[model samples]
Target: MQVFGIAEPGAPAEEIEIATPELTGASVLVKITHSGICHSDVHCAEGYFDLGDAGQMPVTDAGAEYPFVLGHEIVGEVVAAGPEAGVEPGDTKYIVYPWIGCGECQPCRDDNENYCIGAKRNLSIALKGGFAREVWVPDSRYLIPVGDLDPAWAATLACSGVTGYAAVSKVLTEEVDRPIAVVGTGGVGLSAVALLAARGHKNIVAADVNEASLENARKAGATATVLTTGADPVTDLVTAGGGKLAGAIDFVNNGATSGLALGAMGIGGKLVSVGLFGGQLAFPTTVMALNQLKIEGNFVGSLPQLRALVDLANSTELPKLPITEAPLEAQTVNDTLQGLAERTVVGRFVMVS
Candidate 1:
């Protein structure tokens, strides 16, 4: 297999030859079809996360080593499954859920592998990412079948979908009937809108400073769009988000976005920060205590939550999220990761194998 990876933070990614193991090993062999470029990948490459905390991370899992292939949003076909694999040959394609978990951890035992805290935890961090001609997933648990859907689009769903779904569902409560506002109109935000619409939630609100992104949000089932440029952007988002907002989701994960989401939330409402964007918010502790407002941090969901999202994808006839693709080798880093950081990419970018 051929792969592109970085040996160190901020290092130039290079094309390298990777050897594929047997069809039946500790991992499953997937014929790579598509992978998405994400801002998280750039962060990892730039060492925003301490590899020292590499404890229980997929990148530092026991069986794999770096130079890490950064992509985690993956969709591909099963060429061969491991010894205890669930599917047989010729089955429909699926996604690599990305978080390779050690099934024995307390979190894993509870099916909360995304929060695994065990020592020497299982991971794909150092493992080869999906930016390759072929890749191997440490376990079949990571694979979710996506038959016939566009691999590129499905790839976006793997990360962005999981992130959005997890964030919204985490803070949402039955107490509020008002609309849910999703800030940032990128892939993750769009997926959040699509998932909410699929769940029959009308009055889904989308906010972005970009016209193109705002237009894209409309296509993703947003009932209203707010361009966040004027003074008092919160007023616009508050109006777009229902009068008494149930929750505000910030997928941009920056301090500015976090603040906006916080400000936009109505009393007793919740603000969930899901993106890795560099931002912080000074909480309204007084209002939070009095109004019962909430601030929650949501990572990707539990496997079952992800499975449910995939199951919904299997049956839903929702409008396809717009996407652009480039061959893995043909891509330049500036266009994908940097584009994400710059908020220049309208939708997801798929690197086809």
Candidate 2:
């Protein structure tokens, strides 16, 4: 197998050849077709995440090693499977569920591998991911049939799509007609807007520092858009939300956005933070208690949520986010990570293998 990956911490990515793993038990080998570059990939390529005052959290903390492969949003076709695997190897393609965990754990048994009590073995972090010619999945169960979905778009469903869906699910407790703000209308945030609209939510407001992104959010079904470059972004978001927001999903959960999302929330409103954009959030206990506001953090979604998201895409004519494609080469992968880190890419970038 050939892969483009970081050879060492903080080093430029390059191509390397690795021997393909022999399948055993329920294991399956998939031929890579498409892989979407996520913002998290930028942090992975840099080998650490910014931890504000605490310093940097190395990717090694998540069990990543040298030559770390950095792509989890994968769409591929099964090329081979172990004798025990139920899937047949042919033309059928799938979205590989990357949040794998110890099978004996209760969370894994319940299909919520994202919350496994065991050490995290998530792909693109602890394991080799789709920035390669192929990927080896531990179990056939991790493969979700992609069916007729566009492979480029389907690649994102493994991560960004499900992440947005899972975060939006948290805020669904609010009335459908009430305003919900989606902060940082990047690929993931735009997906949340589309999902909210698909679920019949009438009031969806998108907030972003980029006017282009906010405009893209409007096309992705945002009922209103707030450019957060103003003197008071919180006020802008709140006004766009028709006073105060019933819920907010912060896809860019940093210092500014965390405050903007939380500040725009009304009484009893919930804020679901779903980004690796690192920063501490400071909120007064008095205000939190007085308003009965709830704050929650969300990681990438569980296996079940990914399945549901794919099903939703198949069944509904949801507004599509813009997608750009490039060849799955070493330089393309490196450039995509740089683009994400620089916050220049508007929507999803998929590398076709």
Highest lDDT against the true fold, candidate: 2
Question: Which stretches of candidate 2 lie above 4 Å from their native place?
Answer: none
> What lDDT would candidate 1 get against the real structure?
0.72
The TM-score of candidate 1 is 0.85
Cα lDDT, all candidates: 0.72, 0.87
Query: How well does each candidate superpose onto the true structure, as a TM-score?
Result: 0.85, 0.95
What value does the lDDT take at residue 45 in candidate 2?
84
Q: Top TM-score: which candidate number?
A: 2
Clash pairs (backbone) in predicted model 1: 58-123, 58-124, 58-125, 59-125, 59-126, 253-277, 254-279, 255-279, 255-280
lDDT of 2 by residue, 1-353 (tens): 78887888767778898777789999999999898888888888888989877889998988888889889989898899999999999888899999888777898888889888887778888779989888988889899999889989988888888899999889985478789999988678888999999888999999988888888889889999998889998888878878888999999888888888888889999999888878888887898999999999898899989989989999997666779999988888888887877878877899997
- Residue 218 error, candidate 1, Å: 3.1
